[model samples]
Target: MTIKVFDTHVRTKTSRYLHFDVLIEGNDTEKAQAHARQYLLEKGLTDEDIAQSECRFCHVEPGNPVVAQAISQQGYYILELQGCQED
Candidate 1:
């Protein structure tokens, strides 16, 4: 099955933004948003931030279809996830 990387961002209470990506089922925005919420929760992000957070696919890249990486504004070394494709 073909897949695409859904790029998005989530903001914390400190007003810090986390740029990340999700491997969605397709180019559906709803699915991407849902995946973003679930992904943040799984990463231990607070519910408040998760609730207040909004996700939007910035763009996609060509490849085996995986979440690219997470970049922090503070320049923190963020771990990259080989995101799994949604069923």
Candidate 2:
């Protein structure tokens, strides 16, 4: 099993967004997104929220989260239909 790590975020308040990192053991991006979606559902987020959300596959050195990098270095490719949020 190849475990992939994802850094996801979503808008909660008009001016605030929540963030989380999830590690899912799977070989496909589809599986990863599904795992994240389920996790968000368990957190009380609705399907509508997930449908309107976005995701990204990021790369960073081990032990370093992308957020720890300088803002200029922290960039993400917005994946389609896959951001997670807590209600």
Model 2 agreement with the true structure over 34-53: per-residue lDDT tens digits: 65566567667766654344
Model 2: residues >4 Å from true position, as ranges? 13-16, 50-52, 60-87
Task: Assess candidate 2 and give its lDDT.
Answer: 0.47
Model 1 Cα lDDT, one tens digit per residue, 34-77: 66666667676767754245556555444332222222222111
RMSD of each: 10.2, 9.8
lDDT of each: 0.52, 0.47
TM-score of 2: 0.49
- Tell me the spans in candidate 1 whose CA falls farther than 4 Å from its real position: 50-54, 60-87
TM-score of candidate 1 versus the correct structure, residues matched by position:
0.55
lDDT, model 1, position 42: 68
* Alpha-carbon TM-score of each model against the true structure: 0.55, 0.49
Clashing pairs in 1: none
